[model samples]
Target chain A: MQKIINGKAYVLGDNIDTDQIIPAEHLVYSLSDPQESKKYGQFALSGVPRERAGLPDGGVPFITDGNYESEYSIIIGGSNFGCGSSREHAPFALQKAGVKVVVAESYARIFYRNAVDGGFIVPLETTEILKTALKTGDAIEINLNTLKLTNQSDGQTYTLVHPGDVLPIIEAGGLFQYARKAGMIEG
Target chain B: MPMTITEKILAKASGRDAVKPGENIWLNVDTLMTHDVCGPPTIQIWKDEFGGQAKIWDKQKLVIFPDHYIFTNDPHANRNVSILRQFAQEHQLPNYYDVGGERYKGVCHIALAEEGFNRPGTVLIGTDSHTCTAGAFGLFATGVGNTDAAFILGTGKIWEKVPESMKFIFEGEKPEYLTAKDFILQILGDITTDGATYRAMEFDGRAVYDLNIDERMTLTNMAVEAGGMNGIIAADARTEAYINERSSQPYTVFKSDADAGYHSVYEYKASELEPVVAQPHSPDNRAVVRKVQGRKITKAYIGSCTGGKMADFVAAARILKDREVKVPTFVVPASTAVARQLKEDKVNGKTIHQILSDAGCVIAPSSCAACLGGPADTIGRSVDKDVVISTTNRNFPGRMGSKQAEVYLASPLTVAASAVNGVITDPRDAMG
Candidate 1:
């Protein structure tokens, strides 16, 4: 919560569902095993069509072959991002791929909840459509305290929708940690 | 203040006399459903969070089904199923339905009804988006991810924001060719995928109540396609009858007041809406069958939680009877019971199964085969830019296997009609 978040941005179109995030076929890998779970990172965002894989410039890979980590650590998406399936693996894959935050116009309810509760990525809302203004590999930085995002590529700063009700949970690092700190769960 | 059925149900669960939209409350869940793909991950998180003190809040209220990735040969998929089996055995859960066993059920949503767990005026959370399918029975049901499900598994409680309800009224005598699938597709086309995000969709009107339980499920199952939190219907006599025959648990029945508030209301004449399909890559990309006819397809699929029920097959049989399909058509039942019914029931003296088989449709084992593009070897999965018209709920890129393939989401009647001609066809052409 004290750290400033910044990374290269990977952009995508609207309705990028869980299937496009992790795909059902690769859901078999173990999330608990370190070696096996890294496969989730390797396959992250592999299901997106080649034409929309990386926005502004299409077909740029999220993770190059033989690598489990992604170069871009922030994703810019249009409205209804993560619009299908309720798989927490979708968010987990993003986290595993080194993504620290996602700026999107809107989100499907379950995906938004999963991202916050699992402490995978910070899903910030943008009053402006970030996907169209940003290109893949643009450097971005997030202000942890004010939840502000600024694109270093264009020097354009965007205001995020106040994290409001779930801000405490995100700041505490996730629901489990939040509950522990709030004494909602017994240690 | 007046409230809709969804508001009433949430109010009762949250221990309030009345509640309004946008209020946050913790609901005491009545049941938690999980399937093979999500169950193992949920249990792992529960164990990790609680350590040795890990425990299920209510074993009887937790239902596990090894449905997804079942009937697959992939090692990783098999390992996932084993994880669920071990967890169920360790927990001694009464509701776990094992794969390759007598108690096995194909899909968790439909099986929830068959096992008498979908009681009215209850809150049910699950790890699959289609859990909203049970809202057809007049309950509060919605999908959650593994983390929220794990939290519920330990505490049997989860906080939810009350959602403003959208009302859809389908009027007029229900048309023979126009089923609930047609109306839902029409709604999707009009509203787009995110129209009802974080909200409730309540189905009403004469045509809605006129639908049987199976067909009613079809209408509610796709509510998630619109990003709805849940889809609900007020419990009428038909709903009560369906519940009474399956469950004997004492449950409260709640309804919306005549003055209940709604975010928006849409009225449609059921007779006027024609069969339509959500053409490739998006569920809301709808096109009328008449307008899209003669678009060639490589495959026709009839199955999934949304489209693989007995009523769906019955509709398909109505078109495929005494006819042959020109393209490769695959039939997958949503549940094992539905599969058994296809053999036991008859359409014009020939079994529905027989009619489908004679019509050159390949029938796969009951489970979520090829619907979500499961294992690499899943039956009937698309390949090589294959154009498929399927009855499943989703058609997102790579959802049914090949990234290069195109999928069109349609009702069973339209799928069957298209199957006969190897192209998208107006269902009316196949009707008597």
Candidate 2:
């Protein structure tokens, strides 16, 4: 029952810290409700008028606010995603917003583990795929079973391969799920 | 394989043979703590992943506090606290600290050590990067992602890559006013931000020995900013004495062998360091404080695992005790215990509270607060004239308030002095 959606796509580059993920002001709420803090992305743009021109209405579903179009079922960001605090909310917020998987060029060591634990599949794919296959508001389909991503806009498809080491965690539905399947707990 | 301090500690915690660099080993955590700012998201993931089971590990092993976002300025913060409160109740966590009095714990690093959660020869992990501060007490500590923390909570174990260690040999007379903070700042500037990525830094030299336990803690607390996985000082007599002064437990001594191998070696003199500041956007872009002084400041914040130490306060107090804070100042004590000590010191006026209040300083509950633009900041939108001098690590734009607002990083003493002058001024000049 992994929820799949052709949610709005918002693209961000790389090296986003937890502070940017959830500004210190919005951190006062529970992590389960990240949609409530979604508006803070405006803080990232400094002062120019927030250009949500290509963003989906009601804000982008899969990506943060103030982001534009993207075609990949995942985001192909630069080196180091989730580099700051150990705040798990960074990933949870993404998952809750319908990010089926985040395909980063590289990820901070800590953030990589956090994504899988939340059951948000994050596959490490080539950043080159981000060049043409993805554009803003293009609907993309994600298949958890096959780990495939398809962009309906141009009938493009890309095979999402989990990083060699991270495959096990994603297969188990996350760390806690994996722990249960390992019979480390009493039923 | 040669073992680094992180590997050595990981090996000890795992009850295994030495762990080599790049090799993954599961380690037993001596202490695991999370603050309100970082802990809530972790707890949510934990519950979503684990479902209705009392934690897989002992409750006594976990510590929870709402230190970062306690002022309840926005609805999101209020909801966040509510979630933490419920989690604390369901988990029945033994060390839950709220936002006031005995219930009030300041920053998680100081709270853990002062409350005896950081024991010698132990490994502690927190969701906050400053967790490395525990290394001052001879513990292996680092910040982990919420996912990692949740896994540890459920299994009482974590995975780590034994990092290589770099040795710094310092030999020289320490200059007056220059402190361990200045020494570490120089090291950061030399190495750059990515210099120590995934590396263990072992601080040595006669200069290190000259620093007391509190000052040493300041050095290690910000090691994360240097991309260092851990910062450790070989447990010497000073370390032993520090432990003995506070605890009844006996801890065996640990040190590098006479010829223990290191990945790299560095040498620096203590007397050579001047007041250094890491400009905004990066912690490695360090410049001499004198280079940035007189920069206008709109707000001044002094608190965090690094700046709220007793010595940091003493230094700030010595300069600002009877003075007025130039910009609106916020002083968040690192721990309730530190606050109590500040009270006992009779810091200038009738009490530390009255004295700080009279000096235009706003005393916030012990938490990260305005240091991270948490509810503690009431400043309006960022303006070109507004600059903030903060003791906390990291000055990324929008980190304190508006992205347009400027932030200058410095030591607590420097921050206090700057606040009194309404501009960035060297603490040495204020001392003079």
Candidate 3:
């Protein structure tokens, strides 16, 4: 795992639910089939515009034209990110779509746990000021060791509250890896 | 130090005398539940990560229920169940509930209670977010993802952080029109959807304790809607009686300390609360029923872990005894036990199922039939541009089917009234 992550940031508003991240209709793909799992990346953010209320023209699809994988690596979001559904596919889709870190004002409890246990993405809890300070396509640098995020575009720095106890699991690449290291599993 | 009920349960699970909020502990889980929707994937992960030689940590503690998307004829959904059936047989699990079998249960949450897995003073985890519903039994229960569930499958333990507690006190006399659904919607409206993020919602006060076991489950079931880590109520005589009727398992009951620390406390007058509806797109978009009345609806649904209990049906049946539903209405029981109760229990010399059927309501199979918007064949699904009023949680676009269809969330009484009127109408006006 890299201590410093630099990527283009994508911005979204409040209450991004699991359904918006990946709709239930697309969840039929078997996790056992690697060929079908690739389709999940394309469906990431497919239902966002429809579920979110009061957005212009049904809101802009965050992953435009299914090119988010190469275009963006970080998502900056408002409060209640991943607010509904306990589907791990939500974070898995984001991870498959090339999202490495999610900086949100807050997260729904289940989604936060899924993201950490799957080691799909780094869920960073930051202040609301970051929601306003960062914009789409902004160059952002995050230091996992220092819990500091720097907006290279605006020369602003924000401190994120470190999520305790789970840091070791994230550092070990996921819960399974951490379990193996802790002698909790036969691996 | 005095500890909240959640803290005490977590401390005990982690083998400590006491623990505080924000501290991490590894919990030895008592039960792990998974349904058809998430079970196949969890099993796949379990095999992929743990290899073929690994066995489940405990066969009795791991329960599998194939409820959602099972009634439909979709082959993919059927395949998911087949995978679960094979896994259960191979693992020799004792708690697998297959569809159309003698041991089958409808919804996992309600089945957990009826089967006595919701014992107090324990830690339970499920694959569904509504797993918090089990917390009503005076335990610490919450939802975990498929990966975490897989970890538990192999190790029988999970890592968790102790969450801060928020106390909500509902006082005053209960009104005739108000149900537990109404009380929770009021709290959601006041707190917003994410108001209690990363915290435990400890429900107490006169009105909550006065509620029956099923109603208490309703309150805890929707706790996840408010971003609560878990919603809990202390187990009392009501809990004991409810459990004793289902199972005679010995259990330990825990209570919160009077001086336990809470992040915040909210007090509400129960009598003052009105029948409310969560408008389109979000549960937090709540308004009083009178304000949104007369909005035409194409369908009305009363089912799911939240509102498909026997009490909810009784409330709806009271309003629709002789009245015919103007729009399509679906009556689904939460579990097979509830469905059986509906068939056996009489209201006004007729079974509640008969009343609902005579009222032109489609009595669908007891499962999460249309709540999660199952296959195209699922009954009561909202089609293109249809406006629906439902008693299920979540009104997100396409939640019940088509994105163009609008959904208004309400209580069973409100839904019945609206169904009879072909529009959103307050139950009081309909009763009058």
Candidate 4:
């Protein structure tokens, strides 16, 4: 695991559901076909109401129209983030759009498990709500070793909850890898 | 140690005598269900991980239903179903229900009950979140993503954290106007959407026990809407009758110990409740039907696993029997079986299909039409600024299509009542 990871933050408010992360209309696309899967990135977080698309101010697009990748590298959200469906596409879309980490006050269970088990992105639960504390497009540094998030844009810092039992899974880069290490599956 | 029914089911599935909440353990999955939306991707991952020699852990234990996006022009959507068909054909999996076939069942969740995959004291995991609907059988059930499902596919095992159970009790004779939808909507308003996160929701009391199998399914189906690991009711004679009609397989039943611990308890009297709806944009944003009465709506829909059952249609038919709807109404049964029943079942001496059609409801072919807003051509899908009253789960923004549209989630009776007035209306007034 990297000790320090740096990225730009794209924040959202509470109840940011899986439908908003990747709309159902886009679910028909392939997740394995390299070229076809780019649609997931292009439409990542596309369903969020325009007013709640970004934090602090909102109305910012995560990806430019017709583009398959996003400039944002990290997502900051309030409680109950990813609270709707169990579509793994929500996280797959984010990772495909270049998101490396998600810092939220909390998460819906299936989304949290999918993030860790799929090794698509790092879903970090913060002890406190930082959705209002952080702004979209702010420079940020996350230290996995220290479990702290430092905002280079505003010089603010926040503590994140430990990953607990899921830390090994994330470290091994998903459930399959973790299972291999544990000798639960044929290596 | 005393354990909740969910814990006990998990414990047995894991080969343990007891399990405490929050403990992670490997569970032997009794069944794994997947549908068109998630099945293709899960198969892709399973094959990739298990290599060229990939084989399903137990062919008979896997159930695949190509339900979502079945009646679509989208090539990709059709291709997904094709993938599931080919995979099932290769494996000779008897449980595979294909599209355009006599066995094709609509909406995986409702089909799960009609078919006999759900049994008490077992663990069922599916790729769709609403898979928890099977928990109505007193089983441990929840949803997982493609990777976890892929893991289960290869080994028939997946890891789960035991969840604390929450209790909901409703004590009263079920009112004629009150449906399971109203009770669950009331619970959502009280607990918010994430109130029961990572916990089991166990329903009991006379009113719950009074409900038939289809209505019980309505309660468990939306457990995922509240982030619950599962919503369950201990199996009884009613459950046995329903399961026995479809499946002859032997099964075990489980109930919570009298001394089991609960994370929380919510109690309500059924007689005190009235018609209710989860207002547009969120399931947790709730209001009494009377409170929102006269709120103008452009369309009315009655369908999906949450609604659209035989009982759901009977409720709607009772309200629409001799009246015409003021709005464009849609009635898409959750399964073809329900559709056939509509044609044969009677309401006030007329078939439900005839009554709904006379009432100006467009009876669409079942397969989850417009409930999740499929391809652009889907029937009943919401459009820009359209206000809809629907009998479906989850009113999240854009859940039924167009983000600009609004959806009010209500019971079939309430939806039918509202359909008659072209606005949100209480079922109580119409019942008279």
Best by DockQ: 1
Higher-DockQ candidate of 1 and 2: 1
CA error at residue B251 for candidate 4, angstroms? 0.9
Which regions in candidate 3 have their CA more than 4 angstroms from the true location? Answer: A50-70, A130-132, A139-159
* Weakest 10 consecutive residues of candidate 4 chain A by summed lDDT: A1-10
**lDDT score for candidate 1 against the true structure:** 0.92
Query: In model 3, what is the error at residue B405, expressed in angstroms?
Result: 2.5
Judging by lDDT, tell me the better candidate of 3 and 4. 4
lDDT of 1 by residue, B1-432 (tens): 888999999999999998989887889999999998988889899999999898889998999988889988999999988999898888788998998878998988888988889899999999999999999989999999999999999999998999999999999888799778888999999999999999999999999999998888888899999999999988888888888998888777888888999999999988888889999889999999988999999999999999999999999999999999999999999999999999999867899999999999999988988999999899998988999999999999999999999999999999999999999999999899
How far in Å is the alpha carbon of B290 misplaced in model 1? 0.9
Residue B131 of model 1: what lDDT? Answer: 94
Give fnat, all candidates.
0.84, 0.56, 0.60, 0.78
Question: Lowest-scoring 10 consecutive residues by lDDT in candidate 1 chain A?
Answer: A142-151
Lowest lDDT sum, 10 consecutive residues, model 3 chain B, at B243-252
Give the alpha-carbon lDDT of every model.
Answer: 0.92, 0.68, 0.88, 0.92
Docking class of predicted structure 4: high
TM for candidate 1 is 0.99
lDDT tens digits by residue: candidate 2, A1-187? 4535454334545455656555555555444544544443333222211232222232334334465212334444444555655656566555544456665555654566667665654645554445334665666676656656677777777676545655666777776666677776444
Pick by TM-score: 1 or 2, better one: 1
In model 3, the Cα lDDT at residue A108 comes to 93
Model 1's CAPRI class?
Answer: high
Q: Which digits, one per residue and each the tens of the lDDT, describe model 3 over residues B86-133? A: 988887788999888788899999999999999999899999999999
Better of 1 and 3 by lDDT: 1
Model 2: TM-score, first chain: 0.67
